[model samples]
Target chain A: MRLPSCGCCAIAVRCRFWESRIDMPLIEVDNLSKTFRVPEREGGFLAAIRSVFNRRFRQVHAVRGVSFCVEPGEIVGFLGPNGAGKTTTLKMLSGLLHPTSGTATVLGDVPWRRHSEYLRRISMLMGQRSQLQWDLPALDSFMVHAAVYNIPKDQYRQRLDKLVEMLELGPVLKKQIRTLSLGERMKCEICVSLLHGPEVLFLDEPTIGVDITMQARIRDFIGDYNRRYGATIILTSHYMADVTALCKRVIVIDQGRILFDGQLEALSEKLAPFKVIAIDLDADTDGYDFAALGDVLAKEDRKVKLRVPKGAAASVTGRLLRELPVLDLTIEDPPIEDVIGRAFGGSSGVGPEEETSAAESQGGDR
Target chain B: MTAVARSFFAFLRKGIAVMLQYRGEIVLWAIWGLVNPAVSYALWSAAAESNADGTIAGFGRGEFAAYFFAMMIVGHLTQAWDTYEIGHLVRSGEMSPKLLRPILPIWEALAGNLSYKITTLAFVVPMWCLFAWLVRPTFDTSAWQLGLGLIAIVLGAVLNFVLNYVFALVAFWTPKLDAMGELYFGACMLWGGRFAPLDALPDILRWLSGLQPFKWMFAFPSELIMGRITDPSEAFRGLGIQLAWIAVSIVGFRALWSVAVKRYTAVSG
Candidate 1:
């Protein structure tokens, strides 16, 4: 069999072909699982000493039977709380960790096999890890990355210039990475990872630890990269805004199991089957009961907020308008944060039965 | 250039640049490399001087000086610390980034080893000359011996690096490997003839040293350069042993690396 050429033209041609196949999935993962054998011992001098002689280990199933397909040029968000196997799944897909069982293929190659061609075509950006040389200037690290990926000189220069301009990294290019701010360092990390124009990007918390503005800026850059290069991206982040902004589809995982997978708006509609209605009453009716209409979320002097079932939102609004002297009213879906919080069974104060009843009620009303 | 060569040179350039940033630290490390051979020379020379015939195991004070001086240079050239470093890289999760690259991480590490040696040469060369002048060691080296010895040193460096890297693969299984590094260093000291010449050792130790590859790494090159091995066939045999070890080490590295990466937990992200 002939080996593929590692060149810009080859990558461009392959990317265009993959991009043209809109229906074909660029990445396919099937029943993928990773179990880590971690040594455990109680915290104490005696336990530590005893454990040295009689070591005990427990299996931690970081990722359990995770299976997802990502099409070309799509950005899919991997949502979860800490230790939810978000990073673990990304690691396995990026060829950094071997899955204990199951299989994954990215761009027609098994990822864990780690063929040089497969590695050259993909990039993984770990927000907490620094791939650059700490004491050297960011530009130096970029040059090294270019060489490591075997990028042609002209193409390397052109891409470097484009990335520098897009990332606004001209000023910080010559500065040592250690001296740069956390946001600046992250930008440099992104810059180096993209120097090869990888077709697949596994970004684990790409916007983590940055300020709000920086996070948004990084998100924009990532979106722009995906649009321009037709790259397939899998991103994991704790910030709901990141998911809401970049990803139309999200996979919510918890405790090594995928809880939900669908459109972002659909997640809210399915998981949090309620609409928040805020009303500016014209007059304060002290004798009126708001709970009869829906769940009273807030009752201030003039303004009142009600959490009405999605199916009954219109009826509740009509009743409130007829009974109360309302000045203005607006209905909106619950925040993504709240929806995800409820998905994880967090402190959202809503029980599983309420969620089930809400779904049933919405279905029946529809 | 080919992709591998270009990547190697790039890593070498970055390694050299990083080393240049710590001039004082590099000089200190270079001096530390010298101190071991110097102390060994002193102890052995004193022992030779106290002998009835001013000789022990056919080596007088001057012969001991020559042996140690050559050993110092040989040791410096053959130095590798992956055994000490791999554990830290594994524990701190620094190896993950390197593993992501298309090339093997060992290329970058080899670049780092060469860069350190290159950067420290300026400080160490002058110190070596000073040591030679102070010790006034004698030399019986021929042109052919010197040429073959230089070739041996290069082979010895390759052998040492590959073997040490293969051993360092243990870090993937057990991340805390400082004791392993110490054991490796101790073995090299005893068997590689760094602490004392192999012939001067007791019969059991001398016999044991010949059984391992460390003798080919440090002892053979040092003895060859000092013109102690007069037989051409013996010198060739030593080179053959070094080549065999190099091949074994490369195979061992490939075998261990395939398994080690699978075992990597990638601890901290």
Candidate 2:
């Protein structure tokens, strides 16, 4: 069987196609980078005192030459390990930080220039931070934003009602932000941010500490908002479920470099090509050789789990059913967490590609 | 209202709402502001009594009472606390969200300052009036001089605010601005004529105070209201100096702000 084209290569082709049709992308980033100069201090008191007069400094390259463009109405996942320059890139694009070199344009305006016209059309939310006044009800803070954005009284009221109803935020609107649950506060945060109806949204780990149910709800809201407004969105998250659920296309980075950028399914095919099959036998397995079917990855009680190449998974399952007393069985792709772990060169367990095909040869199954 | 004015009023309203939560703090600050003037009045009154003659440093007992009372009002009207605020915002990285807004973050500070002054004055002005009645202080300025002095006081407040804000921008590079704030206040006390009338200081110190912008912030306004500089030409000169300082401060604030913002965003990035 032939493997599909790599997602990263396909992105280049898609970008070229987009360029042919449009003069400039909605968000265009070209070799944008950021570097920092961190001071170094010696441990000893004498050395520290001496260093004060003549400081030692080291250059830290937080973001290297990273280039990518986001088209209008695209919900793209920005996936990367910690310290991989995800937040730095977001800051540069949002005008919070200027890039050390290179340039980026958001909605045809340079982000670092922080043009009021450009700012009024974009919004950003960070998960761990709260922009709402803590001691005041979320409504009051909403009013502040309404004023900041200069929303006409009637328009502001209309938008507030719509957002409140859509988010089911009536119960929590009157409560002070500090008293609200994390999820409730996050909802309010999202609501207040959208009162301006910005064209572009940058969300950085917006569900970091939210519970599973809340995370799902937030993801749904994000999807609904994108569809309703045709708003372009760029989200960075550690949860694979979020990326897989909301993002059809994802950009993966490691060490400030773009490792992969294209369709989400294509990424799985490129990085991890095998699937897992778990079998639960009705009878004891002492008399049969399970390893002949595939490489056994794990075994416990009467259940056996096996790893096999994607192409061979069906044939191997058919043979197992014919030759073994199989009570139940299921085939699934490798978990994305493990795949990304391996992509970052994590050596804690089996490497994604090196995990050879296997049937669960009996160990504890008997 | 124009767009900018609308935004300013909106922020002003929000600031008032937030400040209402800290009413206790306002009361405490008002008390502290009054105490400084009380101390100055007491010291000057004692000096006037001891002088056998009816005057000390050109201040009669009634004149000293009037000077201290005016000084108290001017000081409260011109107070700035932006150094502590900007330092906290820079230190804790809370300035991030503020910067993302279309408006400059400084506008929020300005609005907040205005709200605080307006709210506190409601309570403070009545108390000051009662105190002035008890002290029986005299006001000798003509109607025109009094009107010009009010303008001077407003300019003085703006000058002090811009001066402190410019200094506070140093927090972009270093979070430890408390020392700098204290240093600035100390200079004001020594040279801005908080402790005594500029006439009471050594000739050299008084000359230096006149040359620097410090005296114009507090002493010039208070003295103008008290009619201490009776010469019309001298009073006009004082107003001119205050205007010059205000111009200098605005330019300095913009320059420092540009550099500080660049340093902050670059380093934090």
Candidate 3:
């Protein structure tokens, strides 16, 4: 409702405008699905013995009938719990994996066809894998990358200079990959991946296993690169700081299907529409009947915390102030982690009953 | 053409850097390559000496020695390790990054094969010269014949590369390709003259070797250089077979590569 001011808001507005302006999506996914056949085995040793002679296979639907689209120059967070198909979708989109059914087009080319033109425009960086020639220096790997993408010599040098300066990789570029630390190697990997100047980037847990300082630096570098090059970025990370720091719109999936695909603010409002009210009581609060006012989350010797519906937060505060000997009070939304955890079927946020019903309701939308 | 050359050179440079770190492994593999021919020379030399005519399949003592010594050099020159390398890459999920690249992954193998030969050849050529000094091998061919033999050797190297590449692609469907590799090497050993000269192979195996591509890969070039096949028509026919097999192997490679990539994407997904 308010005019945009912050960098993220401006990005959101710009992304929306571009998304509306373009007739064709830069990345279009239509019911893209992948199913894996895993050999099934029982727990008992006898069953395991039987399985060798008469093997049984089970089908795992890793990515199911899912569809989405991304406009150019947009940063979208693809978030899901482990085994929720985030990485699977990324692989399919990046042409590493072929879908079992349906199709996906990146830069107007079928990803699975793996046209050289299509590949030149996209890059994928997985945290678990290393693209660098391990025995060679990162600089040598950069030249190999430039050759692979056919970047002109002058363009390669200029891009390499900018990346090295931005990533603070001047000192480590000459060292062998085996000699570099994990953070240093990751920085080099990112630099080499971008030297070709791809228009689309699929980053899967790029900051995983790195230290906090390095994680922050990489996140900032990704933002800077995206802004500088107008690259459409799809990122998946377990670290909340990464998602909050970079993505304005998040696509949350569970059980191999999208549960929510919209703004982060809207997700919080829809999933967790309650505020936590904490009051510092003057004395032991055991005597106070706080359960009638709201769901009491915690009751300490001198303070009590209650979860109140957002609409009734002001009334509950007024009643607590008028009736109880409250010294001070504060209201806060539930933590984003808790909201995400609940969305992922993790216990400890919403009750299990509510979590199940909420998941069921959203499951059909896919 | 310039872009292709640049990428090839880039791959070559990076591949050299990688091979340098494995210098120890290169020595061990070179020794392994040499041992096969050395033992064959020893066995076949004894066999020739024991014959009533002091010759087996028209190969006297000097001829047997010359055949295997050339066999060792040519075998090393044309050997391809893509079967094991591609198997490891696919099984360990390392092929993901390669698939993401614009260039086909086969270029990496080709560059690696060339760089490895060049570096180890530093030692291999000296070893060859030492053997030549001791054995005093006879030059039995003209320059034009040697030139044609060299072209055949190059095409033979490519044929071996594509052949091993196609064999390695089977790893995408099955996890274990060790047995397959052993089977392939056994066939090469029997029919490709690794154990003895192709002239020493039994009639059926000789027929089979002539029909297949392995003899062109290993024996034909050595025989051409050693001047065993004196008939010009036979020499030209060998070269023609090498070219035809190279073409066939390339077609097979492209077909298998697409299917293997599809299988990899489907299963590894």
Which prediction has the highest lDDT against the true structure? 1
Which CAPRI category fits model 1? Answer: medium
lDDT of 2 by residue, A123-221 (tens): 989876678888788998888888888888999999899899888899999887889999999999899889999999999888888899999999998
Candidate 2 error regions (>4 Å): A1-21, A42-47, A271-338, A346-366, B52-54, B266-269
RMSD of each: 7.0, 8.1, 6.9
DockQ score of the complex predicted as candidate 3: 0.54
C-alpha TM-score for every candidate? 0.86, 0.84, 0.85
lDDT of 3 by residue, A206-251 (tens): 9989999999999999999999999999999887678878998788
True contacts kept of 1: 0.71
lDDT of 2 by residue, B169-261 (tens): 999888868888888888788788887888888899999887888888899889888877778788888888888998998999888876777
- On a 0 to 100 scale, what is the lDDT of residue B138 in model 3? 56
Q: How many angstroms is residue B223 displaced in model 3 relative to the true structure, after the best TM-score fit?
A: 0.8
Where model 3 places Cα greater than 4 Å from the true spot, the runs are A1-22, A43-49, A270-341, A344-366, B136-139, B266-269
RMSD of 2: 8.1
Residues A109-163, model 1: lDDT tens digits: 9888899999999999999888999999998999999899999999999999999
- Give the DockQ ranking, best first: 1, 3, 2
TM match of model 1 to true structure: 0.86
Q: What does chain B score (TM) in every candidate?
A: 0.98, 0.95, 0.95
Model 1 spans with C-alpha error above 4 angstroms: A1-23, A272-338, A344-366
Score candidate 1 by lDDT. Answer: 0.86
Residue A154, model 2, lDDT: 97
- Fraction of native Cα-Cα interface contacts (under 8 Å, chains A and B) also present in model 3: 0.71
